[model samples]
Target: MGKKISFVSSKNRGITLDMLVVKDFFRVNDEKVEFKDVVANENAKNSLVKKGNISIRKEYCKNNTDIICVDGSIAGKLSKNAPEGKRVLIATPYDYQFKAINEYDKGAFKKKNTYKNFTHIIVGSPFEKELLKKCYNTPKSEIIDQVCIPYSWRLNQEEFKKKHYDKYCKHYPMLKGKKILAILLTGELDEDEENPYAEVNWNKIFDNLDEDWIILTNSGKLLENMTHIGYQHRNQFVYSNRTFDTREVLSFADCLVTNSGLYATYFAVRQKPIYCLKYTNCEFEKYMKRKFSNLYIKNVEDIDMTKFSEFTSENEKFCEYFSYDCGENPSAKISEIFE
Candidate 1:
């Protein structure tokens, strides 16, 4: 059916954002999706795509003219001579970054492609749709909101302790008997080059905190010294060597705080209460936090560890805002219900 929808991502490492979206599309086991049959990069098992249960191959994209543009990168991506069957259905977040799709929609940065290509744009929010219409100069009809997001899961905190805690016990047995607080820091070096994380003393932060914490990150530069600080789950202090299950990581986090992942942002907005710090690697996120939602922070200091009600309240509002019913229907978030 639908010629086994072929999903593609721009990168071949870690948990590419697009793969997560595909997972969300399926939402359940009974409702499986025939994702694009791309092979996983040679060394991508630890990557996020693997967590999604999808396989990714190299850039063997035969330009399946019927390619789906999930993210907001311009490039009508569909060629003119390509068979009319080649359609690009993009399942994207509501926000467009630094440059608006408008920049590309208007013809090679010279003219708009709304009239040129048969591109179907699926946005997560209505506000984003409005923005697309304004920027891409496309008709409102072309911009449809499908709240249906990518792979989603309920926080099975119990499952996390059962599966991961023991592994840590072997590395740092001391960590086995303590109440822990987890602070996850998503390294932004890949996106923000100037800020090489060489100065970030993960060792110091953990040492200074009164409570025990297992810091999780993808960057390993500072992990070399986790042992010096009496970190019980020293090895539990994982750097996303390759993007292991993010939700697993998220569930593992008793207390949550992350830089800014589209998934994390979605979690934050839904009242998931992930201490969203100010200024994200992406401009659109900053726009959402500072300008759009109150859950956003100017800095880590802004968060009142004592009163977390603020985050929960904001999440409730986020749930009410769009309802995302536009994305699919009553069951758009059904997986969430079952979980």
Candidate 2:
């Protein structure tokens, strides 16, 4: 019939965000996506791609692959080695630290030639499309703003509930009947910089928060909260001490309190009442504020329950401006591009 659709992930280590979107797209189509460990193909077993199945063998992506989807890093390598197939470069700039932004920008500029090999460049937001056009001089026609969400939140809602709801309920029994304020924090430090969380007085936030609120953080620094004296509502707070599966958490969360990071983009797309905290000043956060007016918190003390309505009213306009569609089926659109 037609050319077989295949994906070539750049990484041999583990699953990348690009692969997740691919998995979600196939899953939605009710089509089988078979995975092979290229490096260990002799002993590798063919596995179906689904939620939680994220391992990719580099050898699986060979010269015969028809469609190769990759992040910006592997664009050149795939171009030089496998020039026959159509390539899709997905841009996920928000998934990096402030310091890494410049490196990524410069790298994209250097790899302008690789842009020619790619059939299209899929970007998450219009902002990313603009960045590539301005910084790398990538052609506007080749860029498609998908305005999608992360795989964690994009999985089939029914499947996610069936597979994860019981597990979440087992671990977070206290979460029932509470208004969740999912606070996603990046606790890790840059190569040489100080901890960004240190700038925010987390202890103060915890002390002022009531029992009705459940604080779930993805940052490792929140472990200190486990033993903090102000952490009186032990059941109300959870840390990133282990793998934090946020599928159920986001579903249960009434509102989201997070920094002006990638997770904030997720909340914005969901149109959830979001309170964006700016712990450290960065160009990205400044850009977010300018684009999504009055969405930023001047101070942590300003976070009140009453602001949800005002925030919700602005979400529709904000998402529209960015071309982010919370209701859009990303997999359907992505599949059209590849198939």
Candidate 3:
């Protein structure tokens, strides 16, 4: 008998990488699983696999495949169109235009009901599991939380740190000697969706910076004329509009600040000092507070540079809630069922 899984994603690289992490886990467990990469509604001769940079074709989903994932984008449409298989979803709901649970005004009910097609749904948090149950009416049993993602398997931490150091030396050579303050910004998904953090006046936020700031953004675009000019160029503020390698940036960061999103969950797993840039009424805020209450920052003015120097109770709490115990592989648990 052959075990096969077909991973499908529309275009988001992040989701595709998530699928790759899952693929890596299965291979490590000695599972006889053949993986296919399917790009919906497009054709490419060959593509570089996100993990290990192996090259492969954009293959079509084959019959007898056990699972079909509508990763990140095009969940409703692709899931409906996919062939008869065990459908799965890898999603992080943000209550936006591309939200897993959409708004009622524009076919939210119809869209959410489509989730019943999946045999399982993978999420990052306990809060998401409850949200899915409450909002999408998904069965509790189908939502699985395997918090120990195979990120290290995808890219080793040492390699990530080396790349970070190389990038720093080449691009932002001025940023040295000062403590690194990493702020993760949101990526572009839907243009029409209102951003809750838009109310934040960035100029006011960065006016009196306490440390050397590194803006880690998805899009490679930063504010113009924002360069610092002084004799102490060694501790200047800089930004990278590039898609962040989370572990690499975190390896050298003295403090971490981000909005409540997938990256916040990633940060929680590291058991490091974290400062959450609060977004009112955002679904992620609720989840972050539930899992990382001690890390929650209520005010932008209250972001303390000194907090990074010490450990907090939240670090232990975060690990307890979000991290897998030592020598315990949640991926192996998932493979036992999914494979």
Candidate 4:
């Protein structure tokens, strides 16, 4: 009989995508491997079905499931519920576990050992693995350092353009013959329920941009706020409420300006020109700086707009450092463990 693997993750689209990638790899490579998705979020389930035509299993049983692959530490809670003898594999970044530990330190979790349920943990890099070991004292045997992305491997410029250029041009006709600048800024509500981005100097940032450049963003809130600012280059701004894949927009973009998060990681993996805005002194941001010091811009004033127009060979180095461990086929690497 073949192995029955159950993939699990929270509502996070990125993490869910990771699980789906692994599932897809199994389907293509191993006919004997039977897989099922066990996502709890409706949006995530819908995304899986929409992107891969994958169906979700309402529930999974230990007797039927040979292994439980949990994507991200946020979904680690699922591991505790797995059958006693069932193997649980957790693929996560160090920041997720770091945040959970910080919360646990502040009495958010009742249990002293939150990772007790995990049989093995997969991390992106050796730096991440070392961080986990320092914090959780997790043994080296249980930690696997592998690159984890939604795709089989990082695509070169030619391959990336070939895959997404036509679709992107069709969807965004107005942006044609223009320098596309993609932005992924996360929005958050303040304690008093006021718009957090209202204080930003939107006019200062957009007013200096050339007319030939179009600003593209995924955050609708940012679009709404920037539109209200009535900047000189207001017409050059475009918003994508995730109507299409972000990768499509990124494919043709001359450069990307984003805050520290998964989007930055994705852009880096593509070997594209990117600038990370330092809005806060978060631990993750600090770690990113240590890895790629030149990528960080202090603030809007510090942004060297000329860099966007100039392509450099530095991006290959960034991808090399960022894509350490997992290499081109992290999905296949993980699959080999169970095979």
Candidate 5:
């Protein structure tokens, strides 16, 4: 009966400690939180209650009407379960990886949380609601596409660049200057039954970029012309080297590089010149077209340094669906939500 809420586990507690414990939602509700209706792996369920973090079993979630979801499917499921007065909210960041419709891929059921439909949906813009509509297909009356993300509080993207942008610049042997090209790259799931990655070697692409680049990755050995940075270290085009908090790396980036698709969330942070393409022999590119801001670069010659900035600045399409806002971001907005 308290401000108790239910959450769907990302991967049976596969979510890193940093993702949940360090996120804005968790931080905001520090003492005013309780997870009674929890949905997660047995290990996660046990761990939370054993640690006294949650109050009951995750299955308790099925019967409870009070719930909100960080993902779409869960929101739909909860909406189907709630009583007439009870409701659900969608609090996750949105993008191409998330569909406008409920898509249960091979592993989707495990993460599904929504029941019928949410009473009200929260989003960053009408654009986000439009994307959600692509999935939920509900009338506009049920959705609330509000600017709720708080990117300002996270860290400065510019600071991130200053801290490590030049660390190995000379050593990496790439051209450098304020007019730099930083590309953050990601890909959609591999669907090719015969060949994955389409034999398109990434090293081949990075080798040809006549500009300084940092390939951020959680793993894959320290890369050259690329920053093999981790998730927390990732945000805008740059951030304060002294701190992980994000500022304006995106909007200010001269050139941005990424292999990420809409499934990845870094793009939601700030706007910068961005370069991305679909993985060969996959439906990823088809989905990327939904955003319409990405460039499909097939060869080294197709890579245009000048256009990187152009893409980031022009990509206002994604601005709509992102909601999982962070930063010193929206302290006022957040207070109002709880108010």
Candidate 6:
């Protein structure tokens, strides 16, 4: 009999989606291999169900499974409990956030033996592999660098436009002739409740925009404030709640504006024009600025409205240095380990 693998993921959509991509690859190519999905939440379960008819479980079970493909952090916690003989595989895109770095600096992993159970660790890039080596003093032979990108990355601009443009235009008639400007906010509100974007000069930014653009925002709060009478371009903005898929909006967008995160990387890989906002001045923000030096703007007022056309032309150059290899077949590379 072939190896039986169980793919596990946390509740985070980014992690779950990447796990699904790897799972789909195995389903199509390795008919002899048996596998099951173990997701943390209902949302992840729904995503798996939407993909195809597959066996799923809420918790990880190692009884029949020869290999356990799970998230990085979760693998650490499972190490002590995992049976001695089973191979634990970690295929994750998590870019080692500030908290994890701090914990590593404090020698927390040494005390806990966090990654002791992992048989193979496959990360999205060399950057992530280096982080794992630095943090856990992991052996070079155990770690593999394979960039796991979103399945949507396979869709080119022409294909995406043909599939989604007409449907979106029908729903929002104003999107017909004008250029679509997608604004991606973190959607996190502060506890103070005064104003989340108090640092940004929103009024001056909106006033400088050309009238021919249709602004699409994911934040309802930002949308409400922008649509108020005080803003000059109130009529030009449209809001989509969490229920609406951001990828659909990104598919047809002419350009994107955001403070760095997973969505920003997605837009960058699509080779689209993106203007990055740097308000938080966090570590990740600094990393983004380093990657997109010409595209980073400290303040909203720093954006030059007239230069958007020029910016769009330089997207390929800007994204050439992007860390992840979205063009490579990560699933194929990962499957080779079993072969």
State every prediction's TM-score relative to the real structure.
Answer: 0.55, 0.67, 0.61, 0.69, 0.55, 0.69
Judged by whole-model lDDT over C-alpha atoms, candidate 5 comes out at 0.40
Per-residue alpha-carbon lDDT of candidate 4 for residues 1-339, written as tens digits (9 for 90 to 100): 888776654333334545666777788999898776555543445655534322232234323335545433222234335454444454444345445445544556443244444556656544445545544533323666656444424333467566676666677776778887887665344556654455567666666667787778786555556645564565677788668877556546778776645555555555667776654455455644655567776664454555655556565665544545334577766776776
By lDDT, the best candidate is: 6
Q: How many residue pairs clash in each candidate?
A: 27, 2, 1, 1, 65, 0
**Superposed Cα deviation of residue 155, candidate 6 (Å):** 4.9
**Candidate 6 C-alpha RMSD relative to the actual structure:** 6.7
lDDT of each: 0.44, 0.53, 0.51, 0.56, 0.40, 0.57
TM-score: model 1 vs. ground truth:
0.55
Off by over 4 Å in 6: 1-3, 10-15, 27-35, 41-70, 77-122, 140-148, 155-161, 198-203, 228-235, 278-283, 289-298, 301-303, 308-318, 321-325
- Residue pairs in candidate 6 whose N, alpha carbon or C atoms collide under 3 angstroms: none
Cα distance off (Å), candidate 4, residue 191:
5.9
What lDDT tens digits, residue by residue, belong to model 1 across residues 98-138? 23543443443543443224345545555455545555544
Against the true structure, candidate 3 has what lDDT?
0.51
Superposition TM-score, candidate 6 onto the true structure: 0.69
Off by over 4 Å in 5: 10-30, 35-58, 73-88, 91-116, 137-142, 148-255, 263-265, 280-284, 290-294, 310-313, 316-339
Clashing pairs in 4: 147-326
Q: lDDT: which is higher, 3 or 6? A: 6
Q: Write the per-residue lDDT of candidate 6 for residues 34-83, one digit (tens) a residue.
A: 87655544334576653332222213433333454544433343424445
Minimum summed lDDT over a 10-residue window in model 4 is located at 53-62
Deviation in Å, model 5, residue 192 alpha carbon: 7.9
| Residue-level lDDT tens digits of model 3 in 202-265 | 4444544555554443322233333433434324456665444544565556567766455544
